[model samples]
Target: MRVVLSCLLMLLFVPDWMGEPRLPLMGKRAVVRAAPIALDAAHPARSRVGALVWLGGVRLTSPDRAFGGFSALHVARGHRVTLLSDGGNIVQFTLGPDWRPRAIAFGDLPAGPGTGWAKVDRDSESMGVDPRDGSVVAGFENSNMLWRYTPDLRRALGAAAPRAMAGWPGNEGAESFTFLPRAGWGGGAIAIGEQAPWPGGTGRAAFRFTGDPVREPNRGYRFSYIPPARSDPSDMTVLPDGRLIVLNRRFTLPFTFTNTLVVIDRGAIRPGAVVRGREIATLAPPLVHENFEGIAATREGGRTILWLVSDDNQSVLQRSLLLKFRLDAPGTPGSARP
Candidate 1:
């Protein structure tokens, strides 16, 4: 009886948002602030050796306490962005001509397959949108589930937990998700684990689910993605020519963040095959880096644009960052990397 009483008291003292998903009461519009930031505070004019050129960046803040923890992002055509928070909230905003955000909206995700109590239960870490119909698919970590929504991201369409994700760690289930737009390879959605080490000493586990994974869960192939040492895959997006660009991140003690952008060939990704990417660029200290957790790519008239967003972890010590770059190379697949 004494042990039971003690456990009950401990639970009472714990924070209400510990593991379950929590959201602010804000309906559609929310007040968010974006402050201009430089690629390198010390040397703002510095540039990397590869084809990527830093365009601009901003640090985002909000009055709402539940505003941070943005882990996944999808950038649409009109400078509009949809961000997924670790707290199970979706924030949508559009950038104006000056790169400042406007028309911000905040809302909670429709309840799905999870405890629905703690943030971890709704810890959505990766997201991708179908190019054909603009349908959105979000990957949740704790439950190892994928939730699909309409183009507007208001209603839940369907969800599923693939059998291939059976042994994935609850905390690191799905952090890298993207949709391949090329029709040559039978375009589909790909999901990869963040910290889930690959079996047989290869690397991280990855799955390519052909067709809608929520409907045809078993129609997919498994593979491996090998990133740089000590780093984990954060987000992935496809290039114009069928290749994939994956973002990796590593954090060191005392608050140091490092980010790497890798480009992989679609031909190298297949069942039982291990795909390794060529390091295209590295973002570290002295060149403006943060806990960048999201990545998206788009093709402009003559160049490829890359957009990245950071997860602030709702900590005062960190800031939500959005960085943009222009890859000055041909849009053909695999040409930008090599």
Candidate 2:
């Protein structure tokens, strides 16, 4: 009986990680449940939000500890949405018209800068997908690095830490990124640092990589972006017709975050040029709000759809939300305009 008790105690002390030195949900299937939510809590019928009309939204949650902290989002070919977390975790799923999720999956990045033993080693804050080759490029904050991965994110292709981003603070590096295809610039990428202001601190530091940022960091050049007052740029996407969409977020009292969407003409972006975006929509007050950090654009028929996903930060006081909006005011983004 004494030997049996000793053996049981030894089993309890076994290393939970089994010395694998990895993060959780390593390509493991994760189930996410989303409850329907409306744009206006009190007035559910009010859908008009600036230039956008609410199509649908939901509060997303998961029982797994590896979920949440989704800092970046990508919707590919109008078929699937991929959520990338700051902790190197990923959730991919298809959302139906009814707002239900199908073919859900959860995974972790296979490789990064560090040994994968610490959270900061995988502090990937921004991501962009290459439409030409289906490769994924992720920007890590604490390490201030960029990594290119396979389409499935199951393997790493290349990585680089550009000189243009070398001066950015560890925590404020490359918080927003997007692949800008042939906007008269021969298909490059743009990255925005969250709090790293440009020049005299009037705007955030932005960069345009002339090619694959991970593969060709040398061609990156500096630019300046001035978002709306009191807001920080979170995520960015290029419209189908070459316009730029940027998501800016601000923190409010009593623990909540507000969001604003801005549009910049593609021509406004240039080396050494200080660019600003026109505010088109905002989510605040009675409207559904959270720490929205990710945004994606897709086309459905003749409408350009905007999707937003929130970063919960893995806190009980916060919430993860997925919102869908239809561009109603018209203009670029291809099919969205007449």
Candidate 3:
């Protein structure tokens, strides 16, 4: 009786990030329910948080069991959004005129390394999308691979296993990914490990690929990045101005998650460079709190529009939240390093 009770208690106290791995969800198309949420629950009129202006927010829910666990997000023209879960599931939806979710669809990766029998085989953690052609490059965690896919993400094109990522801790590998528009940086892609510290320093390992990471895995270089204190990088996206918006997440005791947004200047990235961007915004209690793992930015009417998606880990204790914020200027304050 004591052993059984001990096991139950251990399960109850497990951290939010310790949620059980989920299988792929290939559900049918249906509208997802969204509840408009205030940025500041206690003060509904408040909208600003740190350097961001909360434009809108929503708590997304669905009867489908696979509706949550979104880890990476992409917002395209006409507010069409595609969310990729770490479990290799994909959810595509459009925002109605009123910002409600519509035309929702779910899909599982057509093919991945190994038999899709185990979660580790398909643990896709981050992705980068080509702006011109809509092609996608997915970064798998446990396998430490980069896989390219069609615009619809229904078919695999090619895949590669970069040598630098071979040593990244399974769960912490390739959590931050983006395609660099900066020609000076090879105009290829950048991927940063979530928590694997560099061999010689405290920074995490980051890599720059000269072309399709899957096609030219050996044509680039590696660097290091110092994220916010005690935070792990989850996702990142490039801006029209050649800057990067990185989302870092933290989980605390008693099941709490907070996110920090950092912006790195285009000039700071280079071969073997150790970069730490400036802090832009902080998302936490009193204002908001969730496991915000994905961040995407785009230019709209000359203003930078930022979108964040949370990974609920498919736990009833948490929520799948989608938020929008406006960053008035691209040039942010001083850098942060610790």
Candidate 1 lDDT, 256-289, residue by residue in tens: 9999888888889888788889888888877788
Clashing pairs in 3: none
Deviation (Å) of 130 in candidate 2? 0.6
Which stretches of candidate 2 lie above 4 Å from their native place?
Answer: 1-29, 199-201, 329-338
lDDT tens digits, residue span 1-338, model 2? 99999767756875343334455553354788989998998999987788888898998888887789899999876358899998898899998878888899888888988766667678888899987898999998878889999999999998999888888888899899998886465898999999877657559999999877877887967889998989999999987777889999999788767798999988888888899998888888877889999999988887788989999988898888888888864553442221
- Candidate achieving the largest lDDT: 2
Rank candidates, lDDT, best first.
2, 3, 1
> What tens digits encode model 3's per-residue C-alpha lDDT throughout 222-309?
8889989999899999877778888998899988887998889877888889999888788888778899988898777888889999
Better of 1 and 2 by lDDT: 2
Which one wins by lDDT: 1 or 3? 3
Candidates in order have lDDT scores of 0.82, 0.85, 0.84
* Model 3 bad stretches (over 4 Å): 1-24, 182-186, 330-338
